[model samples]
Structure formats: structure tokens, C-alpha cells
Target: MNQDIELLAAYWTIAGDIYPMGPTEVSPFSFENRMEAAGQAGFKGIGLVHNGMMDTVDKIGYPAMTAILEKNGIKHVELEFLVDWYLSGERRRQSDKVRQELLEAAEALGARSIKIGPGIGQEIADVKLMAKEFRLLCQQAAEVGTNVVLEIMPFSNVRNIETALAIVERADQPNGGLLLDIWHLERGGIKFSEISKIPARFIKSIELNDAHKYAIEPLWMDTIHKRVLPGDGTFDVPAFIKAVQAAGYEGPWGLEVLSDTHRKLPLEQMANRAYESTISQFRK
Candidate 1:
């Protein structure tokens, strides 16, 4: 393993023109624009999320997008995905196909990992069930020469670093890993005191963002609502970064923010803000 820690610039959904689009105003910073911006910003890589995949891919074919990533010297892209289609039920084949699509996407984009937000339901947290299912996914990911990184989201069944590690432990595969997003860490009810307990080996990546005390009218009426920028909000992002550092996690860092207000401002400016906020927190 390289063991090098670098940051991957993400455009959650540079194309979503609707409700859950990213916080930063959608910029002309399309695939091409991101490539142009990467070197100047010192973004070691790109964390590509579906927060706009549905619309973005529809507008531009995956093959085309992948080509763009390659031309830009981007070595990998971490995809945001729903991983429920891979269970031992009616949708098993459907699930397999989805995983294959991810594999294909990796092949196209030359990505290293896919961020798997495993579906949660009554049986999702079942120890044995999640293990079996995750193991299968890991096997598939290995075959594709890619990694499966479980992302911890607010209201998630595996909503914290602890739960994420537990599930990965059960999976027991080298390709299995976890993603740490600060927004989810803050909202998922995890405190810094719990950091030492989280295993360092499984931390595949870390996400960055800050928030405020007063909540915005729920991003939607749902539990996984919206979020603000790194410095604009009230969350203690610097402390969170320090905790991750103490935990011995050395991996790619992602500057992620899900906001509409951000989008209205210049995308380049928002990206600069994210870059600045991340540096300030990492130093703290």
C-alpha cells in the first residue's frame, strides 16, 4: 500500500439542477473543468459522487466521462452509490448487474474505489446477514481490482466509524474499507471521545465539511437532510480532522459539502473556500 494521504476534489453532482443537488452552485466545472482545476488546487485526485450521477451520466456517457478522468491525470474517483441490489433475494441478479456497472465505471474512470452506502432496513444491521452480503461484494470488488468503501451517513444503519468497522470486520476481506465524512460524524451523534475505539485499518477515506448550530430547514423533510460549508456552519471540523489524524488514518481526504447556497456563488470560489477550510482544519 502507498500509505500516502492526499485530497480528492469532489463535485457531488455538478449536473443536478434539482432538489438534492450539491451545496456549491453547479459550475461549468464539468469533467473537463475539474481536470483543468485539479493541478492548480493541489487536489491529488477526484471523488466522483452520484449526488448527480443519474443526470450527469445520462447527459454524458460513462465511457466519455472515464476518458475525461484519464486525460486529466486523475488516478482514481470514489463513487457514491447505493449497494442494496446485492442481497440474497429477488433482486440478487439486479444487484449483481449494478455492481458490474460500478466495476465498468471503475474501468472507465480508472477509479480505485466505490463508496458503498449499504441499504438499511430491519434486517440490514443483522450481524451475519451484513457480513455474508459484504463478503460477496468484496469478492466482486477484488475481481474488478477495485475497493469497496462503506460510507457512514446520518441515520445510517452503519452510521458511525464503529459500525462501519464492525461491518468490515465481519466482511473480513482486504478490499473492504470505510469512509469517514465529517458531516455524518457530527450528525450521527458520534463524539470525539469515541475516536480511539475506531479501527485505523479500515478507514478507506475521510470527507471534510463544517456546519452551524441552528439547522437549515431540513434539506428535505427526511433524516438525511442538507448541510453547509466547512467554515460557514457550526461543526468543529478542525477537531474532527485532528481526531482522524490521531486514529492513524492515512488516506485520501475529500472536501464534501451538500448545499444549495454554495451553488449560487462561483463554483471556483466555493472550491477555494473548501480548500482553505480543509487546510485550516488539518492544521488545527
Candidate 2:
């Protein structure tokens, strides 16, 4: 394994349930099994979603869960998918509860960051208001000793590098930054040149995935079910890697292939392939 790369087994890589779309009916791998496979496959980190984290802790104690990850040699942890923070009323309150739990879990698991994003849609919110909310979220996360990273998605409000960077700048919290995913960058039409311009400190993390040059129909469905392995698609992954390295991002790099087909593989096979495919990019 390349010590500099710190490959992460992203949540969707092994998650049994795909949500909204239902279960993938893949390998019925348990959390411990996933961690063990990841470690054996040379992954240094593993991502945990909010529901997964809660369920894992409930089924096994937090200490026991931590022990399993430690025994598997997992170092970095990532928790994700907080939404509705920009809304007011009951929706925001519900989201806040989930966010609080996620932040607490991140602190407990020593996760690098909690990924947050706006709901998927074309509607854009007031950047200032978004910044204000982001600032408060960062402060809250800071209290738990975790970072809050805003993810830019093609269908989300923060749909481009510029908008994501702007919100992070306005928030101005050291613990608040951007979670740049290669898929989103490509689908959102963000140039690698723009990514190179971001200051290192503002890029909290980077996730790698590949897809066709032209988007599949119903982009959201395709994103959830059709992402290819890092080197198997049309993405200029080597260039993306070089750009981030040039920008001075030294954080963990995650393999976030969210494909239904991928979820059906045996645990070890999935982990090994994900790690191998991702590291091949850095080698180039």
C-alpha cells in the first residue's frame, strides 16, 4: 500500500441497503466483515453512514465496534449524509437531530469529517444564509472535535467548485471545508483547472469514482447505480489526482463507487478491487 494515499472504503462500496432504491441484495456482509475485508484489501479507512453507525453501535457496543475496526487496522473513519440544515421548521429540527448524532458518532469513532450536502434538486439557496448555517454546523462539529465538510453534488445547490468554495470561505471555520468527489466534479462540469485553484486548507477530503463521459439518463439514478471503478471509466483520474496533490491536499482519498452491481460482490472481492483500482490512479 502507498502510505501517502490512505485509501478509504467508502460507505456505498459495501453498504447492503441503497436506500430509496431499496436493498442491493448483495453479499449480506456485516459491519465487522466489511472492516476486516477492507483491512485485508489494504484500505486504511472506511466510511460509515449515519444509519449504519447508529445500527452498528446498537447491535454491538461502541467500544466493541471500535475494537473491530482497530483489529482490522482501519485508521481513518468518515461519517456522512446530513441534509435539511438549510431549511426551517420541523424539517430542520429533524435534520438537526440526525446531524447531532452523526457528529457525536464521528467524535467517538475518530472520523475525519461528516459529509453534508443540500437536498438533490436544481434550486439554489442564498449563499449568505447557507454560510451562516454552515458556520453554526462547523461550530457544533468543532465542539465534538470533528470537521464538517460540504459535498458538491451535480443535482444539489452547491453544484460546482465555485459555490462550494464560496460557502466555505464565508463560513471561515477551520473545521469547515469542501469534500470534493471526482464524480460530482465531472458531472457538474467543473474543470480540473478550477480545482487546482482551491487552497489546500479548504479541501477537507477527496473522493474518487468514475463514470461515462456522457451522463446516463436520469442522472441521479445513474449516479446511484452505474458508477464504474476508478480506472474503468472515462474520467481523467490521473489528472484529478495530480491536481489535488498540486493543490496540497494530503487528506485521505476515498473510493466511492456507488454501483448496484458492485454491491453484489463478496466482501473481500469488493474491497480488494476498490483498493487496487483506486491506487492505480495515484501510480500514474
Candidate 3:
């Protein structure tokens, strides 16, 4: 294994005994257990979903959470899924509430980044206004010493690398950047060569996962339930890893394997498989 290529187990990758897109989104496994499993699997970091993280923080407090992370050798923390950040009215109000919670947790835990995006299937009517809002959001995050990473999904309005690049470029904050997921990039038909066009500063984070050559109908369902581990499917994950590395992104690579089959595995197995498979791609 290349010790230099550290992996951050994305929330869903090791979220054992959870029904994704179901009524309950939080993991059944405790935070301490999650940290232990991730650490033992050789992960240097772990991503946490907002609701689950808030519940854990409320129960144990940020200090306790940080202690667990430190004890388990988890260095990088990613707090995520803040959507509706670019909208107005009641939607924006609700988003602000979640944003406040996520930002506070981020600052308290010294998290590396907070992920955000406009909701899937909700098209942006005013790209300029959205860019302005993203800039402001990034400014607020920068105040707390973290970066705000926007995930570009095929189901979302900022659906491709080009449109996502434009928003980040316009947002213009050093802490504002994009989250490039291999599943999204390949499923959305984005070429690997496009990775070169993005400046190093704009590539805030990268996620590694694989899938069948063809996407299932209603693409979101395919991503949520069918994603395979890196190198387990048709995606050229090794090439993708090299592309990102060549693009100058040195941050921890995220292993975001979201699948129903994966969620049913033992926590240790889930974490280990995710780490081993992703790290193997680097060796290629």
C-alpha cells in the first residue's frame, strides 16, 4: 500500500446497517465504533453527514468527538450535504439553519471542508445570483478556517465539470472549490482530459468509486444503490487517480461507495474493503 495515498472513508462507504434514501439517514453504528473501524482499516480521515454528526455532537459534545477522532488516528474531517444554499425564501432559511449547524461543527472539530450544492433536479434560474451566493457561503466558511466543496452531480443543475468550474471561478474564494466524484464524472460523460483544464486551486476534493458501463434509469438511483468499489467495476479508476494527481490535487482522496449491498456488510469489512480497493488503484 502507498502510505502517501491516504483515504478518507466517505460517510456512506462505512455507514453500516443504514437504509440510504430511507426515512432514517443516520448510521446505526456509534461514532466511536465508526472511528475505530476506519482507523483500523488504515483510513486517515472520515466524512460525516450533517444530521448524524449533529446528533453525535449533541450527545457527546465536540471535545469528546475530537478526542475519539484523535485516539483513532483520524486526522481529516469532512462535514457535508448542505443543499439549497443558493435559493431564496423559506428554502434558503432552512438551508441557513443546517449551514449554521455544519459550520459550527466544522469549526469545533477543525474539519477540512463542508460539502454543499443546489438540490438535485432543481435547476438554477440565475447562475449569476447563485455564484454570488456561493461566494458569500465560501467567505463565511473561510472565516471558520475551512473550505466549502460543491459536488457536481448529473442530476443537478450544475450538472457537469464546465458549469461547476464556472461557479467556482466566479465565486473566486480560495476556500471555494469542486468535489469531483468518479461516478459522476464518468456517468455524466465528462472526459478525463477536462481534469487538466481545472486549476489546482479549484479542485477542492476528489471521490473514488466505480460502476457498470451503463447507468441505470433515473441516474440518481444508480448512484445511491449500485456503485461498486474502486477497480471492482468498469470505470478506469487508476487513470482517474493519475488524472487528479497530475492536476495537482494532494488532498486526501474520498472513498464514497454508496450501495445497498455495501451497507449490509460488517463495519470492519466495509471500511477495510473501501480502503484496500481504493489504495490499490494508486499502486497501479
Best by TM-score: 3
lDDT assessment of candidate 1: 0.65
Query: How displaced is residue 120 in candidate 3, in Å?
Result: 1.3
Per-residue lDDT for 19-95 in model 3, tens only? 45677778899999999999999999999998888889778999999999999999999999898898789988999
TM-score of each: 0.81, 0.95, 0.97
Which stretch of 10 consecutive residues in model 3 shows the poorest summed lDDT? 117-126
Candidate 3 displacement at residue 269 in angstroms: 0.7
RMSD, every candidate, angstroms: 4.1, 1.9, 1.2
Model 3 residue runs over 4 Å out of place are none
| Candidate order by decreasing TM-score | 3, 2, 1
Worst 10 residues of 2 by lDDT: 19-28
lDDT (10s digit) by residue, model 2, range 1-284: 36667888888886653633354323356888889889999999998877767877888867888899899999899888899887899989999899878977887888888999866785775789899999999999898888888998988888977788888899999999998899988988899889877888999988999987777778888788889899988999999988998898988898899886877777778888888988988878
Better TM-score candidate (2, 3)? 3
Q: In angstroms, give how far residue 188 of model 2 lies from its true place.
A: 1.0
**Best-performing candidate as measured by lDDT:** 3
TM-score of 1: 0.81
Output the lDDT of residue 51, model 3.
Answer: 82
